[model samples]
Target: MAQMTGKQYKESLKKVKPVIYYMGEKVDDITKHPAFIPHINAAALTYDMALAPEFEELCSAKSHLTGERINRFTHIHQNHDDLIKKVKMLRAIGQQTGSCFQRCVGFDGMNATYSVSYDIDKKFGTGYHERFKNFVKMIQTKDLMPSGAMTDPKGDRSLSPSQQKDPDMYVHVIEKRKDGIVVSGAKAHITGAVNSHGHLVMPTTAMREGDKDYAVCFYVPIDAPGVMHIFGRQSNDTRKCDCSMDQGNCEYGCVGGEALIVFDKVFVPNEYVFMCGEWEYAGELVERFATFHRQNYGGCKGGLADVLVGAVYSLALAQGTAKASHVREKLAEMIHLAETIYCCSIACSCQGFAQPAGSFQADPLMANVTKLNVTRNVYEIARLAHDITGGLLATMPSEFDLHDPTVGKWVDKYMKGSSSVPAETRMRLIRLIDAMTCGTALAESMHGAGSPQAQMIMIERRGSLERKKKLAEKLAKIGDQPVLIC
Candidate 1:
């Protein structure tokens, strides 16, 4: 079989019994759990789009190893076209789900691991690349959703892994046997932690020599014994329980519910282990993954921006300000910000580069810049959305109050802007706006790939200040020569 259909994927989830916890209860049916269902629905969209004629080209690709058609999430991007298709596919999914689908992290980890493992083997004569290929092929064959777990629960930002207060704070190899290794520690803010069929884990940061225990990378089934998921809370997430209006994107999962995934003495077989005790290449592996992760923010965030823009515009109509001069101007400003993000996304893809293994990577500088733009652009986009929405975006009454027979008529009369638009319609628009702006939506844009600070670091590292200085010097012939800038 090629890529699995949405129905097939949902059915597959029933076979694997993963230990998942959300709110205060143990979740047995992940596919249908109230807190987890919307995320599953969002992920199912990844499967559904593969069968759509218009999106198939962008959403699926032939696997580089097995030559079978697989979701693009499982395929290794091979050229500039692949990169462009990737960005577009992310945009399409964002439009379809209008929220974080919580699957791309694994897609990125697979690609990043594929490249890094290949490089590691070349330098150390290991068979990691071949081992990784076999694992990826299995994932593609099953059409599995594997969440990539990278970030650790770093207790102290100032200390290194070896110097931490707790030795297990960062995932580390606690036992090494002839067969494999046992890793004990936890990953924090693990996106889609409990919902994934499998988990692909790697180092969150570069490692030094003594930190070899912390440099391990491998894949394991989410249902692996000793693995546990503790779901995180988001702003207004209990609305999920209420199942009410104004919760925003209530039908779709909230900001891809992240959880603290603890790997307590988890064991991996020798074949499944890709990176182990490779200190020197740790930096290389991290930078490679980070660059691609940063590249993704542009596509996904730009798509979310579109939804926000659409929400604001829709709210304007419901409020009867669609024709007002200020409304028109604020809407225009929103459009400009939206397109700016989209342009950055497209530019990064267009300027993509090929790897030694034939996979494509976006220009590091451009990709980081794209995400940096996402940080500021999305906030401003929300500001404009809020501006057009007026006070009601913040002060809108509860649907319950409006639905009460005693107050329903009063709400219909006073809580509306235009006689032509129904009060309920205005309420729906407000709910949509509230969903896209507060809580998960904003956080996704700010820290989806990495935080704004992470992008700033990338900018500083990849930016060419000397070259910029040279351009100015050349105009005045003030310097002897321009050193090539990194």
Candidate 2:
């Protein structure tokens, strides 16, 4: 087995020197930092599960390249079953952790790179395919976590990368030396960048003829010189430091710990550069990566929905409303939405076929459909959770008040919902619901995989509306008249 234990994973982070800033201060050790530890714990769960007998099959896979048992997070999909298993693994992790495990983006990135690099080689006779295969093999053998960098900070939404007033608005190759290239720009909303072993950086969008500099892709160590990360702030992030009860899902925190990673003239050796100035293939790479990433939401969010449902159910019971007709109906609705997303993920996976490079890819249409529904479904699901939990979710008193000598007794008395359930229990459940529904978790659900409109564009392109119109015309007895326009 080429996998590390949770303890080993945490120990490994202490060796890296990633320059990370949080709340205007440099974080020397992310593993011990309160703001990052919950996310780390969530990610560590992925490692811990692989060591268990029951979860071994779901969390570990036989690497195609090395024939060794490797973490599923590092294995490229070898078949449709592998793809299906990926979703199942994500959901299982989600259920257990009740938060983003923060590894799926890297998993998806490797798969996309595996297939797209082969296609790029076929088109332009580049050796990127072989280089990428070696990279994947190294990742699996070492069990490294590679954060996928795709989203860029678009200074002007309407402008192209080349048109941005700031040349570094999109990551680009500033200097191509004999050894390799130096890239300068920043990748935004990068999930788990601080904790990951390194990054698999890819272009954020398609490139035109003049955008050659921006059409670059490569990998870099997180602690590489000139690479820096500014940690993103989450809702109630400060609560992590002071209030235990108020920090709902305290063990796993909120969504994936995201950050802005800046590449300031970071040098990459030739072996690490997968694509450079491949303007034509940029769109293909973006689509492949984005589709695979979108498919991930189904499993992870489904797992999250499971947690939300459980929290809502617990809160309902705490408030003595679990058996009400309307409550039951709303709970059922939440289940329906969650299952629907999971089904889409599975549908896309089951429908997948092998790519040219022998890696399986989900059906683009179904994957986009899965994500599009996620954009809307997660919100409604959270809405029902909030509806069931009631006003206490937002207006609940801090844990300090519950423990205060002056107000503790009265707070406990009035906060108590039922004699059977403890006041503290009721308050805890309410806090959990509040954090999951109203915090970073919900935002990630809305915009994590290229946002709602991006998924819609992919869906529209894949839909083939003209074919549907043709079917409608044929059914309506409208013949194809060639001379009607005269």
Best by lDDT: 2
Candidate 1 vs. truth: CA RMSD? Answer: 1.8
Task: Compose the digit string of candidate 1's lDDT tens values, residues 105-163.
Answer: 99889888888898888889999999998998998887788898988888898888878
Which regions of candidate 2 are displaced past 4 Å? 480-486
| TM-score for all models, in order of appearance | 0.96, 0.98
What's model 2's lDDT at 358? Answer: 87
- Write out the backbone clash pairs for model 2: none
**Could you tell me which 10 consecutive residues in candidate 2 have the lowest summed lDDT?**
477-486
